[model samples]
Target: MKFATTLSLLLLLSSILVCTMSTPLSRRHSLSVIRKLNREGPFVGLITVYAPEENAFLASNAFKPDPRHPFVDLSGRRFRIGKVRGKGVVYVRCGVGLRNAVAATQQMLDLFNVSGVIHFGIAGSLENSLRTGYVSIPKQFAQTGLWEWLKANGTVGPEYFAHLDIGSYNVPEGEGINQLGHIGYSAEEFYSESGVPNVPRRVVWANVSQNWYNIATKLEGMELERCLNSTVCLPQVPKVVIGQRGSTANIFVDNSAYRDFLSKTLGVSLAEMESASVIMTSVANGFPVIVIRGLSDAAGGQDGPNSARALGPLAALNTAKVVIRFIELLPSHKKYQDLK
Candidate 1:
């Protein structure tokens, strides 16, 4: 009886061990384990915000998924690993919003040995010269959404936070791209860095990698799709415009008054929800970044002027094409120069 009982206990213990080994860990635990092992990366990171935006990368043999581990699931985000244009890449969907962008980009950086980051997405044109389907690779990015929300009286705020009049504003009905504004938007205040304490840093513009910017400039004359389908075409042929300015915030801007204010006051050519945060995160992590944006609308409150819903996909595809080409131009050596 004793022998039989001991054998039964041993079998039960073995079964429990097998079950524990077979069961997957919680997402957080999985992330911790991956972070500890750190085996997944060292590839260029391709980040997209919307599904349609990533679909472009997907459609080109869908980026030819990485044979080893095609997808890595982290909580809700699924990062796709693959090769695009013959260069290794880890693509991830960055959900909309400033926080989401920061989280996704940081996660990608943390999870991989990201040589550099290339972000492609759609934006609303603050410049009339940039039409739908036109791609703009901004020279730098500003996080304009970090406003002081000053009182109606505009009394007390940070000295650097420019006071924006919330009321009526205007610009020429239709005009070319205006120059960048001299006004000060709020700069991010960091209290400490590199183990130094009691030091504050104010960073306003996050510049793009000079190398990437130069490569993007070469694509100025590249052809882009101007139509979603046969019957639906843009007003003009699509082309690339390099070296403009873009800004990001949590706000979804549709008001012409606000749009013109941002354009004339800040010289913002393209406005979107994610670029600044992505750039900031990359900068913090010592990674080089390049942003490619396609103009989907004019950010005008008027019905016909705001065609983002219709043109978003077309714009996304145009930017994705530019991203792929940009990738082709990247040095095969992963140790690309980072932004200073």
Candidate 2:
């Protein structure tokens, strides 16, 4: 009787172990099934917004959340997978700044097979030519935090810089400071070292996809809001303009002198916190990306403090309208049939 009881206990323990191992397998299978379902329908386009104000505009005016499709990623990032004018889209409000933009973009690419990405939001005008509520599409996007080391002195520059490696596609070597070199001075030997810093740094420029650029040109005459409200209004009617360079950095620029410098040095029409990172990530991943920005504030000078508050809503609305039109212009799902 004692031997029989011991054998029964051993059998029960073996059954428990098997069940434990199978539990994880079952969970994995369930996750796989969920991901498969998400990808089964059609190629989805991604639209990202960095702020709640912009998100509010998008939710109300542009894309509608599909009750049938709600998704939250492993990182707890919630997404509204839905349709805009019958096109599949995923809308994510990635919080402000470069890190948030990059992380959210990477997560989306990992989770979904997105056909393209479009980022639209408010930006400060770097050039006087642009004013609040004017929508501008970037011909090229660049990051602007790099500094050049002054070889004459050990000090790093006031010289802003950015670099792109050779052989990258769709990257234009823009006019200012475009050269190939190492990060810091490197010499074959101590004797070969130039007394000055020989460190190679190229000004990096990431261009919008040519196909998207062509599409933007077609939107040239679209009307934009010039008024803050019926009571307060812009001096002139605003219009959508295409093909200007834009720069991005974490810094909220409020100085007039620095704004002028950026305009001249980078040929930048608008400055913002997130677009360059989004463009860079999309380019590296071989995904097409476009950025449409509405000028909310003139970077410093007279129109600085109240510009974003006064013009932000109008700017966001203008950008959303353009994004909607762009979505409409996208070719049928048949073009993306093979993507599935």
Worst 10 residues of 2 by lDDT: 185-194
**lDDT by residue for model 2 (172-271), tens:** 6333442342232111111112233555334367667777778778888987666656886777788898889987878887777667767875688888
Q: Write the per-residue lDDT of candidate 1 for residues 1-340, one digit (tens) a residue.
A: 9999999999999999998777677664656545543454457898889888877667756387867567778858888877887777888998998898989998988777678899889999887887767999999877887765544444544666454654322255324432332333578754323424667678778778777777778888888887888977888899999889987888878887778877886788989999988887886667788999998888884466578888888888888888888888887744464332
How far residue 163's Cα lies from its native spot in candidate 2, in Å, is 13
Query: Cα lDDT of all candidates, in order?
Result: 0.78, 0.69
- Model 2 clashing residue pairs (backbone): 181-200, 182-200
Strongest candidate by lDDT: 1
